[model samples]
Target: MEAPLDPVSAETVSISADQRSRPYLRLFLISFVLLFAELACIRWFGSTVILLTYFTNIVLMACVLGMSVGCLAASRGRNWINAVLPLGLVAIGLACWTLQAYERGEMSIAAGDQSAPQEIFFGAESVQQAPLGRTYPIEVVAGLFYALIALMFVGLGQVMGRAFNAIPNRVAAYTTNVFGSLVGIAAFALAAALQTPPRVWFALALVPLLGFVTRFRPIQVVALVAILFLVGWLPPARNGAARQVTWSPYYKVVFQPSTAVIETNNIGHQQMASIGNSGAAYLLPHLLNRDAGGRPFEDVLIIGAGSGNDVQAALSQHAKHVDAVEIDPVMASIGRANHPNRPYDDPRVSLHLDDGRSYVRKTSKKYDLIVYALVDSLVLHSGYSSLRLENFLFTEQAYRDIQARLKPGGVFVMYNYFRQGWVVGRLVKMVEKAFHMPPIVISLPYRAKITPDQNQAGATTMLIVGKTEAATAAIREKLAESGAFWIHVSPAKNAALNGYGAKAPEVEGTMKEHWWKIAPSVVETRGIGPLPSDDWPFLYLRSSMIPGLNLWGIVIVAVLSLAILARFAPPATTRPNGRMFFLGAGFMLLETKGVVHLALLFGSTWIVNSIVFFAILVMVLLSNLFVVLVRPRRICWYYGLLIASLVIGAFLPMDSFLALPGASKVILSCAVTFVPIFFAGVIFATEFRDSRHPDVDFGSNIGGVILGGLSENLSLVVGFKHLLLLAAVYYLLSAAFKRRAEPPAS
Candidate 1:
């Protein structure tokens, strides 16, 4: 009967008080579904799309942008809710098909990541690029997928927008939304915990989505089936090649038993074979360790011990105690079940399913030999940021920790097909800096095309670091005595070497020989380049700045986001609550800072991420309750508190906290990390309590999240600690922009 007033626009919803309970329940359900779907989209797209495995934040920002657009569309009475299924199918189907084409080497749909020597993308070079003018270049493929992912989630956002408008009490409605989102994140975490496949993720998301539809057409039914079927089994090349897919918390692990090879997120991860042929690379480090005089490394620690090839090699080398540390359980299980040598089943082998850095921090027993065996993570640590899982593992701080774990005069070996000279050179410098001695770096002598004067550059390189007097000296003496101890490379080229022998693998003739002692030439000549540290751990990046590909991607996303908002969002006749927008932006930063801060204190593991998300949500819930019950006044006071908290956090350094007692470090770290978030939540909840147009206002908030996600990239340059100051500025902007308005309706 009432043409209700929505202050932001002329649009009105004919919602009644009696309709509250069901609509609110539906709102909760819709929030749950959408959050779960968003998480699924991020994970699935990162794992399925070829180049996007390194672009998780793009997926995240797309979801935020989509939500903002869909929520704003709510006031226009346009419903994309029914389109969710079809859009989702299109997004998933497109990814699957593209991935199939990629797998078959039929197409190149990369994200302008190729030709990037400044950053390392594992499979970018292998992608067959289409000519720039002829085909829609693979670079644009990521943008297309970004739009598709955004479109897929627009329906969920629209439903939430509608539900928010249905309830008269804005605070209650928002609280419900937060609670629902909390549940949704938890649900996804549970799914991750269960190690559910993509099909189960789709099914879980589909159940709540059906509640939003007034009636289910046959098209919807078929689309639902298509979503499940395509996501579960499409990209037949991937499935058929692997025969089985295991969803780890961090990746889609494809174990190809027939080939004894493992792939994660569409990239070659590791191979499980004996020490005779392909596995000979693993035995090189042991052979190089001449401390026991051909007796082998007695106590070995292999970080990133994927599929037990190194462990197998260790046992073959007669390692008395082998501590094999692998981060992924699925990868470990694959090794245990199918590794030809059955390394994990060996009595002397102790497999630790934990982060390498964390394990190093906790382990007190020094190792006779330590190996970093092709330790590269194809995926980022958290979807919220552009940091890979292996970033921390390669930092100077990490190397120092490894040094502590190594027995005095013990050997530390790192080998990988570095592809770039700068990477190899950079690693050599970090090793020298940490171990206080130059490492014996064995790599084909070549200059980096991108980096100047990096001698020991491309191909498979081994860096042997040690205490000069004992293990390393023994190896150095062995190199001079008979030159038969070997590099971290076996004499058998492709064949796995059964044991040590005085045989050099044939090299391509008429090429320069490798330099066994790779000096820090670049560091001395050009001044040292930025080395990764705990504060700025970016192992793959050439420097602290964002890569060219990422910069271009960000610019395109910003432009597209503007265009989408201009086209689909509610008319710009009325001004949005700027405070809400900035508050949303600030909240995003706070959450990001909390995640990173805690990750530095704890390990960058999936469990840490889940707990941080849960804790942040819980903080929001508490803040909402405080807002409703306390009915706090003066948004300025809350802003002050938020800024104060951020300042306090900025002053507290991450590395300094590592020495604190375990419980004490966690308490102090979480407080510094989350206290600012609580204040931001309070400010948002308090202001939201009296909002005139819930849909428009909430949509504006989502827009801020997109900004925050974009702003997060600045951390690459400024580091995470300084982000606190940036967040503080945002809260200040939020406070400055706050409108003088009417008091509470009560």
Candidate 2:
């Protein structure tokens, strides 16, 4: 009792204690940083790379690839967490700056009417008039840049995997990792909420580096701070009072003072100039005029009412009341600030920040004029799915619902800069099929001069669909007087108009055929393809084939990932775990489905997506906790529960659920949709708890996410709801390969 311990023994004991605690803290930090980096990439990559705006899952796949490579390194007993992570941050910042410079140069040239060298990586397809030719040199250079960015993420993945391997209790480590991820999501979300730019994100990400580094070098700290500042301080490509660019949760919004217009991702979105101020007096003129009997519209509804332009149009027409629905909060805020008419502030107008389709389905009020403004999205809704923000709005079924919201004699008007003749035909067909009546089509040239390359910018097309022929006739007479050129879309209407000696609108010979012959052929052959529905919402894409650049990019990255895995991952780490892989893939699919389903049921706003993601994480964390606390031994029972939940989800009527009141619908939908996800989480946690080498298993599980991302493309063919069946199949395969274990004695 009196014997004193030696100094060496005491030092060894202290070191042992520190070593035991170190991995836990490191794992948590690594997880937090990994998530932060992923979010940063999503935002930055999507904005810089135009291709990513359409195919966002590529960025997600890159993040997964990096993590998988890191796990391989950990299995090989390699650790470069401290050295590579901070350096990676600096590298990413520099890369972003360089890319922005390149983009600015290209855009400036394009805007000046000079054809810039085509970007080979994104391809010539996006450029309207650019000739299709392979620029191998540009492709090679861009590919290397993409690879470098991917490699930076590998360092983060390695740190997380090594920390996971170091921890004694795998379940505890996993729970901690999930908790850290939650924190990472919250931190990023908070930054976004504050409208803090990329610099703040970099600063937050680098702060964790202080704990990782052993020798605190002042130069390293200075370098890191400088990089953060550089990233934040760098000027955007397009910057001026004429152009105001801001980051929104959904898009990079650009407002032009000259035109008083707001564009998203270089695509014309909304004309901010009020009718009274702008020379475009012909725009929505029919809406301004009295009805068939010269009666004024009592109420009007404007969906996709961006920048309050349509609301102002309704107000100028002296409508008693106007309901304006705009999905994006940022757009609404901008409208409130900038709209010269101040229509949103008008007593007659009620602004609803909601999904257009959801609003039409749930609202009790009916309107005399239901105007579908330029409700088109330039980007996908989520990275995983092909669904766009306005996918639900253009569906055939959606048109029917919109028609129901209109009074008996009320007219439904939809107009957009439908560039492709086939796209215009598809919309015309959709509206005709919904109402069983031919819609009046009007095509007008852009009010301002535009280059041939800016064809979409140079034309405005309108479709006027009426609940009755009398209503249609009333609008037709008004539009006829406004010098609007009518294009016959429906076969019966086309024949009747021709017999009446109504000449087709004068245009380029090729363009005339495109509108008359080619347009109708598109509908006749059904070659314009499946009209977007709730089940399959991809309004922009005509075919199931992934775009050329997207396909190539995916293939290249996949090949590169496989090469890295084969070269660095040890043979022992490559052992097949079908159960884990399948579970992981299924879980990812389920998560994607949940997000899209909830977005449709609630709204496609960023807040809804964030809540869904956060809720999923919480469910997964709780499942892991349940596995630890209860130590549930009946794995089969959990599997059964998972299958049952999926069955219910598959057969459950989404329309009926959507019919419920908004609050009740959101709550019930969450419960129904997430129940399967909860059970799936339980199954994953239970199996993970039993894994002997969780680092290897965890890496494999993440690998499954890659496959899941690839499978998400199936939504293009099968539609989204059917994706649950595909997910169930993966789960079944997982259960088939699962190893049996005896229940623990109570």
Candidate 3:
């Protein structure tokens, strides 16, 4: 019923709802479904199986391969959407269990090893074993899942492809598709922020999938239910019980009620324990500070203060104030409610759920003591190698930032069961370089041959650095008087400490004598290890190179992509539009550079990550809008601007953005990061509008994007800044390819 604007006016205006064309609605639905499904699978597969954490790129590549094939095959005029999706979901669910983090035999990729100059998966360092009877190689397992995931997306892509073909104005269709994707990302992100369960995510996906299905038979109904069951399947415990799992923005967190142990992605993450009852290592820095300076710490800061063990320890030491910074909110929540000591509940403790380095950089307060306690997470970047949640927390630049926030005589301590001695040596060197003084070191289970220990690196080692040389001098003097840098509490104290928790690491004969050994010189500390900079904050990596596992993954994905293209692509246009393909490839890298740059300028928090993604799409949308409104025919201008922006971005390093004032930083960073992408999008939309076959061009573009994803590995060798140059090469090639393929009429 329509109401009149004015009561006095007898003339009633009839208003009818502007109908959205069915093809556009279908396009929106399919695009929304594809994005949600892709994100859901990426987040779920890694968290559920745990083994797939390192192989996330495979899942990503598989989606690209599938969609590429599906879109390319749309010309054949056949309905690709059928019962295949649910069947594919079944296969994926089965793959999650058949392959896992650990089994009868160890499963590890190149990053699995604890050696130098190799990619490092942080939380995967601990030796793992499962009760299974047999196992397959990592290569074989990764390959199997890659093919399965790709097959599932093939059907969805074809449906979306057909939708695109139905629309006459390709620009309008592209806008709707991008807008749908934006909505999908925002919705999924909101669901994650709300800490919705896996079932909710799958349910959200099921809504769109049901729309595409033609049949509602009993078998199809069963298939839909089965998909929910598979994705929401909880990891079963050893005693045939399912552990309660919580979905964090980052990972699937499982907390053991009895042991107070918290696990992420089925791997042991942290424990809520008391220092008075076996967490003595947590007090070492304060003890060292007190013994050296004969004063208690007034203000303390604990980065990576997982589950409040560190915070509780600070309180136990009688700190006046404690600032605990933890990245994962779910981890902090469990710590607050479950930790026996109630650290987070303490009046002195203030918990901040944020990225550690980011917190440290922003806080104006200076601390007498700062602790980096056992901070590690398994968060690999989709485009880069072995990036963890805590990666930026350990870089030389990060250390400098921490040092700036320290009180004049403040002492900084970071302790971890760092799997390798080289890791320790690298860390020590970084601290020394940043602080301008060699830090005091305490390596538990210390031994001769500094480069030895079968890569054990003296498990549970601690490195202590003072803000200045004078503070460090006092620490050294106290250590010298104490005979050794180790702690040797009486047997009674040791027993009391172990009463409430697991036994802390102890030296062989440490009832009264030394509990630690004097660290060796830089030479014995291990041959000049490379320092981690802001540009390359890969603390766990041995060096800047792609790990072997990823190398094989890229090759495998490329090969499978080729095979799929050959099989499903139409004979007439089997090859993708090369120009569009190259543009897609280059744009992917351009997009990564934007994300990495902003991540560096700000912090790599989930919020920041999501915003960067949204912003990138927004830029694309804006550029596409310009093309749709203006309808520019010439592409040469955009190519020039795109290349110029790439060059500007490449030369302007991320570190420069760090010093800018708050408002300026946001403004300049966005311009530098988003401008190139904006230009790139304009070029793509212009070409897309001109394409005779949108499906083929799009498929080709996706295929090229896969190649760009592959080239991201080179960032390991050249670093993120140089990636712009590589992207520029691709853009130039794209322009050249277009010029040669379709010359302007003379």
Candidate 4:
């Protein structure tokens, strides 16, 4: 139906096009220089300290070089088979690597049961264990898979240059990309509330729409940053330093509350939270009853081993062997090097750098006393105002795994930080429900000058003890006879009881006696309870509304409005090539999401969050400056788009991994930071290549990011990390769309 296309010469484009994009090349050089600096940092400091920094540098450098060279090589618009094909291969590699990280399914840091028989009865239970298996080697394989996928994504970016040229009504494509991103974000955000079938479709469609949005205008960047910051600061967002207990008079009320200690090291001196030593000090006396402590504990299992204090204490107890499961590797390393007390030296202590749940599941050996110093609630209890809930850590199945690993008569000790009157009842209820046995609770009141009611005042730590049914009734009777505290017994006969032994809170609706019915089976199996509808003062820490929650639904309508507005406006002053606006926007959004997600993956501190927020802010400010400086020429504008995309792709990861893993938490942070950053850099770079204008590009990119943030929070409701994976794929698809649009000229 079409006239012959003039034999579509392979190298027919103007020489001016190459000249036009040189600025983009120059920008790429700057990006590479930045990455070289990061690489220098890694070389001088060591990988452990600057692990994230290293990867970020590599990703940025690769993306910059790839884009700059690829685009330069194809200035004359070569056919897709020659120019874009190689880039597509690279994108595919990157995508595979990025996606591989979560393919193994997320596991906790603590060790627990691994090979236990699944309960074939429950309908939804199978869904939970579907991905469960020997996942260690699988994890590495998965990483490689994602790496390849990322490569594919990069390749896709190279092909996009040609695709946009073929489309009719270029302005319409720009509007569609922006609108598509907004719609995709809305769809992803809403998927959390809807049923599975509809949500699946939304999740699937979200990827390409995201790809389309990445290629937009710069004004959208500011709007996107505003949205990201809004979501980042959402009340429910998780922060760690928010609730860290400072040294205070009330310290006595909380046994084993952490202390910050400054120590000198080769890397210079810094302060770190010391928890294991304090916990060991508190528990050591009880383990040997202060007897001649040449060696008291024969065998030990330490859950949540902080700073290796418990392991040292166990060593002091001279246990023949100890299985130490510390959830935070950063902390573990600190303990290994500077803990003042090191357990790694002990031949008996075996360090398992696995999640506590999985460790217990895999190991059949039982210990004399299983010390669960940190409970399931603590998993979600970051010391921050942002309510980031580690939802998987608190499920009912976790408790059952613990139960399965314990010897029939083994004692289980946990620390419950609550000192309120009726709160003890709730804790006891949770314990009984999980243990399926009556627990003899005892409160070790730390007698200090502080009052308990002054919640801010540090008081002595009170201990909660629960024993199995096989434990002597005399122990229970003794607990019951202690009239010094209020106690609550369950309705069931001879059921587990809470030895609160204290008066209730004076507030209205506060009751003196404490007993609540809990689903024993649920409690015994998984530590997780039903998601609470109403916020509990002790439990609920933060809140936030998703961005553009209402307006997002009509993004298509909004694009239409923009189209009408564009029709009446001064013809864009300078319109970008085809879908460039959409592609650029997708890259920006993908880069930001990648930074944040990488932070989560590597266990990096909230600094990554700060960088992400700041980068967006900087991007907006810089874009405004460029608009004023460059005066809207097509080549300059296009260069501006390319520069912004490359810089974003390169730098975001650097910000993510600047802080290296030193202590347990630090190591966790390192692990979290790199993967997300690498993937983000790769994906964004790919997307940017296909983007046209700055405004729509920025808008759609930001919209995708907003959706990513929203998805992170909503993960509490959904079961898998698939949502996160989908977000990364969205960027990949954008790259693919670019390739499709730009099929190399034959």
Candidate 5:
């Protein structure tokens, strides 16, 4: 019973045990850092790089690419984990600072005699418009920057993959990884909850740094200190009198005292001027006086009540009570603190922080006035899809729901700085269709002068929709008495008829004239074109036409990256099974679909996104635990269950859920959406457990995620629900390709 081991053998056994234990810790640290980095990229990089905000999936795809490269490297027995991790952190940090400086207009380059080129990387040219015409240079530079970011991720991925391969119990390692990810999410979320700025977020990198680099050399220590110092020191520039800068869950909000406007990442969001001085107030008197017929409004509802300016306007109109619904809490808080009107603190105002459309649907009480005031989002809903936060609010059905919320003789007024004449025409047409009557459209210029030649195309447009014809007539009369320049769009002719009278000759081809008379018909005849619906809410994009050059460029880069990966990390001789690849692709599609669907149901707040991501990880963790414990023998059963769940989800009445109580709606939606996700997890775990080479399998899975990210763009062409069908097809393909395995020896 007592055969003693030789000294050398005993030492070797002790070292092996120590090595085994060390990797679990490494796995946890790596997982935590990777997730933290991901969130940082999504938030920090997204805010700084304008294109990143529009095409958010690019960041996800880049991360996947890097991680895939790293995992592939691990499979080839090449691990540069320690050397690459810290360098990657420093690289990303510096890139973020440089981008932020450029975005703030601090960075400049002399081109010939010009101080700066007409088209710079983070200039106005980057926003809203399709990436066409002289945009290639910007695109090239952005692509290279993103590629570097991917390379950084590759290093982290290699570290993680190495740790994962070393651990004998894959399930245990996976659990630790998931747990660490949750911690990362929680930490970042907490920082956001506290309104931590970018500097505080940068400091979070130290957690992983401390864990991984226990014995840093003098040079390494100096580099780490310098990086941290730069993160804190590199101040974000201000446009006007920058009173405060803070991070909301969804945006980086800045309050400028001189302008009295709240901005999201330097873009104007909410004007906080006094009620008398505000541009928004121009439409208020018209609505209150004309629709109310001099009677005081008993109750008012203001959607997108940013900075409480609209609420203050309502209060000034002697509304007895006001319901202000705003989605961003940090923005609301700024309104409370910095608004000169102090409308939020008034007893008459009851602020509800929620999605505007969701509030409209849920509220039982009706109001005399419903104002949709300057409610546009600065950023798109998701990078992959051309949807926005306010997309649901502008839909035709949403207008109908809003119409239903109006009391008898009540008025629904909307004011926006519509950038194009066609956009103004489109909103007017939508209102006419909803109310069965043409709206009274007024064009208010930013400056006091109203020249007939002045292109009213870009002016602040207001639509006053009346519940009754009498109310409309009264509003029209009041506007005429005030000598305001307004137009009544002829719904049938699609012509802009002069509302001011024959005394004022119509300015031909101007918004005052016909002003793109064919805009509405063009929109209508296009057959669901850019007009947003609950199903397809791409409000920012004008059409479904894909940016051909941009799409092709991305594809080329992906192909080239793939070639490089192939050259460096050759696959195993067994041809490395592709069943896992399909499963990975399908799973990514499901996750993207879920994120979008949930964003539509709930608000597309940062909290909602984080929660959805956390929920997905938890679901995957549960699936792995189930497989590890139950060890299901029939993969067919799991696949069948997955398909059935998806089918159920596809047919579920989403509108019915919207009508339920808030908690009930959330619970039901989660059940319908996540049931399929759970089954998908089970299927993946079943296949992944049998993988001969975990590193290669993991890399393949990540590679599939890149394809899934690209495929997500399909949502723009075919609405989001159809994406579920696409995902199901991928899952079916996975099932078809799945190689059957013999039962484990009994």
Candidate 6:
């Protein structure tokens, strides 16, 4: 016998050929299963439950260990996998159990009106919530997941024994590692350019690249290029579809009041005009001057110090020192850079770059006057007046905390933008509870924008003055003088100001008015709604509609995606497999998810427009060029999936939970929206092996990512939630394709 014709070479060739088909089919199945799971879980449970699912990290670690052990046992022996399986399964069960808690809707903080501010210490037990999944805290779950993956890798490596020796030649290993690093660097760079904050999301997008590149197949490079492009292009592309079209950098500016200016660039114009007319500015000087008002306050605390107007009032008074806490770094920078009154430079003004609540915790310094000149409502980013953190900031506990920071003769003044709505009433009650004094609720009228009706809900900026002492004639006299100095808060009524006669409902300690209903009409108004043509979905869809000849600007992206995918394709083999498809799909999905989620949660007027017209094109070109140049293997797929899932599951659900009614509905929607994305990542991560021509696979995966981003933005025009269903259908189609292409089992 010809000694079996040295069949080892033939076997190697066959295996190499088969590898190309493996990943493609596997990814299709994986994506399908995951997508189905997402829809099913969300439909049944709700977003809250899905958000809570991050706590399942406890179980995931165990499951990973079990999976690793099982894989090891298949290769090494039964004993090893079996030994770890019990513990792993137990952990998985525990994770599932913990996730179930979201079903009960226990995530929201309890409503309370406890007065008399005391120090708050979250304590060991309360800190249990720390590791609970949410966007900000996703690191907790991601870090744990990574640790588990590392453990599994180490254990698996041990089981491989001699087989591990044949892993990669020096050249192959170095090349693969470099490719992997490049993929990671490219994905992160793309994510960063898009203004995506540090999270597991970037990691997940790179998972497929890691797996495909490891196969040493050139087609893997295409996957990397696709992913990068998807992320780079999707955001800008969405901007193209907006309805109202206008670009005004003036929208960002802050200016003084003037009717001559039909549209002022400055953001503070409306407030300034209202304040100026109300005679609040005139009275502010009087309140500050001790000789005039006999106001004994030596120091004052001001929050939301917009345009430094409040600081100017403080400077007028003989305040020993004034502490102002403003959250927006941009506002602070702008004030220092351009504001006539540089509060940062003011001798008496000590500017604090921190949230009001957080800053209060660190400071023991007492102030005679604490003025919360915050925008009538609390929204984190740029908005006229929002109710984002209103509950926390206006609570009884918060007021009491403010009281603790005040001196014996101190007064706490809150000027809120409130109509005679339930929000105002609740606020008054909450403040009364803290001080044990009836609020001297004075109505200051100004015509501001309203919700449901663009111009009319008759909103008035209400001044609810609370002091330790009763307001006598003398106090009223002092308040009148102080009101004159603060222009935004008026002492007089104008026709421009809306009426505030409607009685507001009372809010109790345990039983509170519904936030939405009682939420003041003032807060409901979408302050300066998203600018025309700046709608996120519109931008993406518009970009896509541009003709290729005109869209030739992103030529580099097209080239890169094709080039990378080409490089990864097995030159000698015909079939396409695991090393290719997963990377491609994962990349696209990552880009899509990030852009859509960001646009939805954060205000996207300027951002989406800018991305569509400018940033994305540059990113697409850069991503393509980068992939064509460098390639790596075993891209960080496992870690990426783990992180992406944690971020989406934890943070993304807040909107749905807030938007939807029932706990189950919220949880279920969240699960459906998130799970499919998570599973897509997992499939990509599962491919952690050496490959051929890592660059090609790298490019393909990246290109896919670019597509994913594009798809997300396009989905915006089609409908945000509807896109989730579309994603599911696409995954199913992919799965069917894979099943058809796959060979029959032995």
Q: Rate the local accuracy (lDDT) of all candidates.
A: 0.75, 0.66, 0.73, 0.34, 0.65, 0.36
* Global CA lDDT computed for model 2: 0.66
The TM-score that candidate 4 achieves is 0.40
Return whichever of 2 and 3 wins on lDDT. Answer: 3
For model 4, residues 537-559, the per-residue Cα lDDT tens digits are: 12211112222321232232234
In candidate 5, what are the lDDT values of residues 1-746, reduced to their tens digit?
A: 21111112333345667676788888888888887877766666666554455455667677777777777677555544444445655655655665555545545221111112111122243233322222223345456556766776776777777777766555666677888889888888888788777667756754455455435556555655665554434254444344566788777776777777676754557767766543334334433353325576668899998888788877876789999999889878988988887999999899998888878877889878899978877766655455677878876777888888988877888877655444555566677788998776655532332232223344566677777776556646644564443332322122223333223335544355432211011122222235666776655444555455346546766765666466546554424447767777888888877877787777677678778888988998998888877877677888888888777776664455666777888888898778888888888776666544666667777777777777777776777777777788888988888563322221
lDDT tens readout by residue for model 6, 154-265: 2222222112222222122222323333443444334333434212332243333233222344334444444333222211111133211111211222222222111111
On lDDT, who's better, 3 or 4?
A: 3
Worst 10 residues of 5 by lDDT: 515-524
**Model 1 Cα shift for residue 551 (angstroms):** 1.8
Candidate 5 lands at a TM-score of 0.82
- The total number of steric clashes, by the backbone 3 Å criterion, in model 3 comes to 5
Per-residue CA lDDT of model 3 for 1-746, tens digit only, reads 21111122112123222333777899998898888888888888777654577667667777887888898887775555675556566665665555343422334333344444355555554433333443344556677777877888887888888788766566778888899899888988898899998778877876677778765566656777777777766645544433568899988888878777787876677877656756667766666555455477879999888888888877887899999998889988998888888888888988998888778877899998889988877665442333556767777888899899999988888988777666777888888889998877776665544462237533677788888877667667755565444444332253322211122335455543433343322214555346777677776666677777778777787777777777778445666787888998898888778777777767777788889888988998999888867777678888898899888888886788887888999999999889888899998887776555778878888878788888987877777888899999998988887432321111
Q: Pairing residues by index, what is the TM-score of model 1?
A: 0.90
Candidate 4 segments exceeding 4 Å error: 1-281, 284-297, 336-343, 374-392, 416-427, 438-467, 472-478, 481-699, 715-746
- Clashing residue pairs in candidate 3 are 117-542, 117-543, 277-497, 278-497, 486-516
Task: Encode model 1's per-residue lDDT on 439-499: one tens digit a residue.
Answer: 7766533212224234232356778877545556655665555543322232344223322
Model 6 TM = 0.36
Give the lDDT of residue 337 in candidate 4: 63
Runs in model 6 lying further than 4 Å from the true structure: 1-251, 254-294, 333-345, 376-392, 446-460, 464-746
Worst lDDT run of 10 residues, candidate 4, spans 245-254
Which scores better on TM-score, 1 or 6?
1
